[model samples]
Each structure stands twice: as structure tokens, then as C-alpha cells.
Target: MRAARPRRRFLGLTATMVSAALSAILAFTVGTAAPAAAATRTVNDIGPVVSSLELNKGYEISRDCGFTGVPQANVIGVLWLFCDTAVSPTGQRVWGTTAGTAQAFTAPSQSLFGDFTDASGNNVVQFIPNPSGFSCGGTLAAWASGIASIPTSSPNPLLIIPYVVMCLNGTNTRPLALRIVDYDYTTNTFSNDSPVGGTGIFTGNPLADNRILGSPVVYNGSLYFYTGLCTSSAFGDCSAGTAQVAKVTLGSTPFAAYNASNQSGGHRWLDPRNYTFSTLAATSGGFTPITPASFDVHRYPAFSGSPFVAIEQDDIGGNITVFSSSSPTGPFTPRFTAAVPCNSTTGDGGLCRAYIGHPESSTSSKLMLSYFQPSDSHGNGHVRTAWIPWS
Candidate 1:
């Protein structure tokens, strides 16, 4: 998780005022109106060229812990955080990277610090330190599974806001909980902002049974969350349940409540309410079907001039497909496919999962992506990176 340097705030004139000034300047210079150019939509298929890097060696996994790196959130231009899992220790931990440099060939250095934990060193949900109560009173556990940072254009870039998905225990009855936590870069600390929508569980909510995946995409002051429902037969396989996408306003109080009645694909807002959930629709105005697997969505920085990007994972096949969409919820256009390198001969069960990391914080034309290979008799689980070309 590479931390980003602070960026300059834009306090210029409003868009309306700038437009008026531009009009006046144009009139004085040309003395006549110029024809406006029509917008054109051109889709490109020149996908990114993937390659292996040495950065994986920087992540140190303890023998007792079995720490496996899972890329969780990218605080655009700020830092990268991994929602890592420890098998032997049987807990979750977060790891961070130093400031990221625009290096195309080298991997960024990372460290394991700045994570939420209890006095005894057990992993606990960092967001809600003093929770009202846990579903079960035994040893409680939590992880910052997924996170998305607020845009720099907001009140403060230094005030990093991330939505955290947590699970009490690895059971069907105890579904994952979504909550928000504030991370201050200046002070290097976390503040529990409580669960979104007042209560952690939605009761009869459609997404109650599903797990929120990847980092949320913040667009126009709202955060969009992608979710998938998994089956009981096979763990981590979500292909059996219905897939959905939901959204909530950034600063809404008590969070926003979901409206089950108004279930449309586009902007299904229930007025004065704070949030809404909708089934993804295809380009032909039909349901957008998806397989049960992990996926990620992100908003490219303005400079990139790219649409919202999504990387859908195929864990069984060990491949990842990239898609682009003009809006968060849409008929996403598939662009390219990349294979995850695996060494089957070593036989640690040979598994690979491609996880898309933060793209907004990378170079203008490149995004950071990572894949993890679980440890075999040879070594511990390792994380590797590939620079995806966006432009």
C-alpha cells in the first residue's frame, strides 16, 4: 500500500463563471460563434501487456500466521491497503505500501503496520471500536474487506474515507457488515464512523445475504457498492446467487435506506432517502447476467479521461477480464483478458486470484493490478503485480 503525497486543492471560479468568461473571450477574439464539435464514441481493444515484477518479495509472511495478501483498497493518490488473511493465526490483517512512484518496471515497497487490532493482538473490526454488541459473544473477529476513498475534490483529500465490509465469523447466519471508517493521513489513524444505514444488517434487504466485493466507486459525491451472493456448497463461489449493485450518498446521516419497490436499473432513488440498490441491466435494457466470482469497480482519475473500469475474476480458470462502462451501472463493454501465472508442478493445490488494486493513484495511462498464489510446500502465499495500460 503506497501512500500518496498531498495534492493541491482547486479553489477556482465556479463552472458557470468560467463558462461566461470563456464566452466573452471567444466573442472578442473571433467576432462570431464557432460550431460545436459533436462527441464521438470510439472503443479500443488494445488491452494492457502484463508482465511479472519482483515487488512480491517485499511482503513478508510469518510462518505462524500464513499471511496471504489480498488487495482491498486504493486511496487514490494516497495509499494502498491489502485486506490480508492469516490461516494459522486464523485472523485478518491489513498491510500498507509507502508512497507510489510512476515506475513501470519496478514494484512498490510495502509494510505491515497501521492495522486495527485488540490489546491481545486478535483481529477486530477497526471501524466500530465500541460496537453496540456482536451477534455472538465468543471471540469476535473482523476485517476491512473492501474500501474506497473519497475524491480529492471533496472537502479534504487528507481526510481519507473508506467503506469497510466485515464478517463476524465464517458462517452463513452471520452475514458480512458494511461500515465506514475515516483515516487521517496527517495523523495516521482510523476513526470508526459506524455502520452504513444505521444498522449493520438490512433485515429484509436483498443484499443481506450477499458479500460486498472490491472498492466502492465514488462519483458525483455518491458511493456505488458491488455485491454477490455465494452458495453454501462451495465457499467463495458466488455464481449461484443473484448479483446486484447499490449506492449511497457520501455525507448522508443514518446512511441511506434501500427501497425494494423501486427496483430499476438506472438511478433508482427513493427521494429524501440516502441510498438505493438496483439490479444491473444489459445494453439492450435486459438483466446484465454475471458469473459467481470476485470482481472490482473503480473510477479513473479525471486526467485519465477513461470510463469506469471493472476487472471481473475467474478464479477457477485463473484469468481476469477487463470491462469499461460510461457509468457505474451499465452494459459494460469487455475489453481484454489476462491470465494468472500458476506453478502447478509445485502442487500447493495451484490456485490464483487476480485482484484489481487502485487505478486512480497510478500513472495517467497505467493502473496497478495484483494476483495472489496460495503457499505450497515450497513457500508462503505470494502477491505479484502487473501494470495495465489504460490509455
Candidate 2:
């Protein structure tokens, strides 16, 4: 479940609410260390707390681009931040920003170095034009949702990003489309590549209507992704949401050849012979329910014995749930919950959203997390970083 772009503009909340929210947040320090599996699991607030990144204040960091679960990628040595942006709409409304541009960032330190604009002072990310002049009238704009680096046998690897798009006037976003782009580590420039196949087709499960969320995990030489089914024009309600696993073989181009006329293509780099799709099952053979707004799968590099960990937000972004499994398709055990405290206060205007985790920055002991709160008028929206303790 992604956060909706407000259809109309929202005015900042009152100063009183902001003060109360800050007070509540300061009352709790980062919680105690994570206990063993046998002990009770509880939310802990731990940190060397820093100020929130004010992304909405300047012209470069405008609108919904960095508002949701902004995914990250480490190309060569630099950490690249990808999100969708548009000119903020006029008037009062809730969620529905016109997403037209893709923005990239380079973070020299833990914080970002510059604006989302490029050297030309323009937003580098733009949408693919609609040849047929379909429903929405304008170009189909995409927002970065998942990004992964494919390790080839050669020294240079390929960068893959999966994003969801919306027609200009469309009510909801489409499933997802894959783009194979190039990044220069020395110059810190990104080359916009044409989408691999067509829109809404995933390599392993081409026919399945699934909207991919979170970062794809590469384990045992295979890439694993999590998806939510799309029933209608909008995304699946996922009330009885289940986790589905899609695998892409590493080393080669996993996408099929592009067919412009019919919009049909094969998974060129994916090994069709080895690729498989399966639903995650419980120990009792029933389906496990997990509706994630934005989900991420992380495998500990330092601890060889640790399980593959998964973190996801509930439908409303109110609570973050953690699941652990020996394998991607398995009986995942729900371990704990990190309650989003900002949602409880009136200051946030109940607009807080749980963000995704960056495995590239995580270690065996802690995982980095960021959340968005739109009620904070001081910035475009208040983005706060926190550490989730893992034992």
C-alpha cells in the first residue's frame, strides 16, 4: 500500500499540535535492546536523534516524490535516492498529486548533498510518452518503488529499478514496470534508459497482475521480490492480503524481448528454466495475511545464522510489522511491531506513513528506517530517521 498524493493542497498544521507531537516524541528515547526469540517483543525507541530532513521547503524538493517509501540504491560507491515529483496542485485536497518526474539524489554523508535537480537545473526524471493517446491524455509518469543492483560475472553490474505509473487523470497507479538505467560513479550522473519490456509485466510472473513494493533481495544467486495483487484499476485492498514470491535469475538480462505492437515480451535476463512463482504458506498450509504499505526484505551479511528478515507497514501505515523466515517462500514468523507514535498526536494530523528500510546501510545489530509526516508545515513534509534494533 503506497501513500496517496493529496488531490488538493494541504495547509500546514497549527504550531500547538507540532509542539505536542515533538514533546511526545522526545519523551521516549530509543527503546531497550531487542530480546531473544523466547522473550516478549515490544517496540523500543532508540537513537542519537537528529533533525528531520526538510524536503518540501525548496523548489527542488517539491510535492510527492520523496513523500512515501523512498527506495535507495548503492551504485559503485555512492548511495542514490530515487523518488517521483510533480508541480504541487492548487486548492485543498487529500491524496492525488500528478506524478510526472523522477528525481535522483547523491548522499555524501548520511544526509543528502544537493537538490533533486540535475546540473541543467532540471528534474532528470520524465515519463514515457503514450503512443496511442490513451485515457489520461498526458505521458505515463512512473515513481521509483524498488531498485536493485544485479551482480554479473563481469566487473560492471547492471542497475534495475521498478516503478509504478499513473495516467495523468487516472485515479490510481498501475502495477510496475522495470527500467535498466546507467549510473556514473565518478561524475554522479544517471543515464535514463528505456524500460526493458512493457509496463506492468514482471519477469517471473508475467501474466500475474501484481504491484511490486519494497526492495528486491538477492540471496543464493537469485533475486526475490514481494508483490500485491491488482484486482481493478486501483491496487488490491489486501484485507486478506497474502505474500507472493517472484524470483529472477542473476547474471544475464532477466527481461524478455520488447514487442511494441502487442506490448508482449519475455524475461530476457531471467532464466525461464529456473524461475518460479509461489505463494507463501503457513505451517498449517493456509495462506498468511500480510498487507504491507511498503515492504522490504533484508538478509544479515554479518550473521550467517540469522533468518531472512522482512519488515512492512500495515494498510494505514499505523504500525510496522516484522517477519522472519528461513527462506523467502516459507512460514514467516511475525516477530514484533513498531508502533508509529506520531500518528497518535493531533499535530501530525493523522498523516504519518511508515517508510521502507535500506539494507545497504543496515548491519546485524540495527536497521535504518525513515518515516514521513505531512502535517509538519515547517518542511514539505517531516522525514525522520530511526534505528530498529535487531538481535
Off by over 4 Å in 1: 1-59, 62-77, 85-132, 151-176, 195-207, 211-214, 229-242, 252-289, 302-304, 343-350, 376-379
Instruction: For candidate 1, write residues 1-391 as lDDT tens digits.
Output: 2111111000000000011001000000111111112122222222121111122222233111111121223232334343333322342333211111122222233233333334653343233242334344332323333445554433433332333233333232232343445555544566545433343223121123332333456677666655433342243333432334545444442133221112222223221222323112111121133333555666666324557766655444555556666776655655556555533222322344435545543466665555554443244444445555554
Clashes of each: 8, 25
Global lDDT for candidate 2? Answer: 0.38
What's the TM for model 1?
0.56
lDDT accuracy of residue 327 in candidate 2: 71
Q: Estimate each model's TM-score.
A: 0.56, 0.60
Model 2, 280-323: lDDT tens per residue? Answer: 11111212445544555555554346566666555444466676
